[model samples]
Target: MTHEDVWRAIERFATEHGMSCSGLAKCSGLDPTTFNKSKRWSKEGQPRWPSTNSISKILSSTGASIQDFTKFIEPHGTERQ
Candidate 1:
């Protein structure tokens, strides 16, 4: 999946779990701004990647298995291009 697709999935997952970006970050033991959309953009206007540890904590906090998150990483109906 593309970076854009991954980001979209993350947003959707957070919504489905009834979480704001800051809420999710807090649940993951990260800084409140860690998952904020504003922080997604870097100084050069490029998207930054979420850290693996943060992702892991988020999944655990939401009671979602790693497999579920992985599926989001490569959702169906989205071409692999």
Candidate 2:
């Protein structure tokens, strides 16, 4: 999936859980702005990928599985890094 897709999935997941991305991050014991939209892009216009550890924490905090997150990737097709 594209970088954008991953972030969107995270956003969707947070919304589904009745929380904003900042809330999700806080619930995961991460910085409140960890998933902030401003952090999604770099000044150069490149997408900023979330670290694997962060993803894991998000999934654990939300009680979601990798499969659930991966599903978001399918709708957009796999992206060539």
Candidate 3:
């Protein structure tokens, strides 16, 4: 999937798990702004993706598997896992 797709999944995962962007970052031991909207885009307007290490940390914090997160990347109205 595209970087934006992955980021959107991350956002959905956090919300589904009852955490705000900052809350997820804190729980994942990252800077509170790590997942903030401001970080989703670069100064050049290019998409900014989460690092694998950050993804792992967030997965651990939420107890969600990669498969579970991937479910969020399915079509906008599709069923969720």
The global C-alpha lDDT for each of the candidates, from Candidate 1 onward, is 0.76, 0.85, 0.84
Q: Show model 2 residue runs off by greater than 4 Å.
A: 74-81
Per-residue lDDT over 1-81 for candidate 3, one digit per residue giving the tens place of the 0 to 100 score: 677677778888889889987898899999999988889899999988889999899889888898987788855545365
Residue 46 displacement in candidate 3 (angstroms): 1.8
TM-score of each candidate structure, all chains considered together: 0.77, 0.83, 0.83
State the lDDT at 66 in candidate 2.
92
lDDT of 2 by residue, 48-67 (tens): 99999998998899889999
Local lDDT at 71 for model 1: 66
TM-score of 2: 0.83
Give the per-residue lDDT of model 1 (tens digit) for 7-80.
76677678768888788778778898887777777999887888788888889889998777766666547634
**Candidate 1 — what's its lDDT?**
0.76
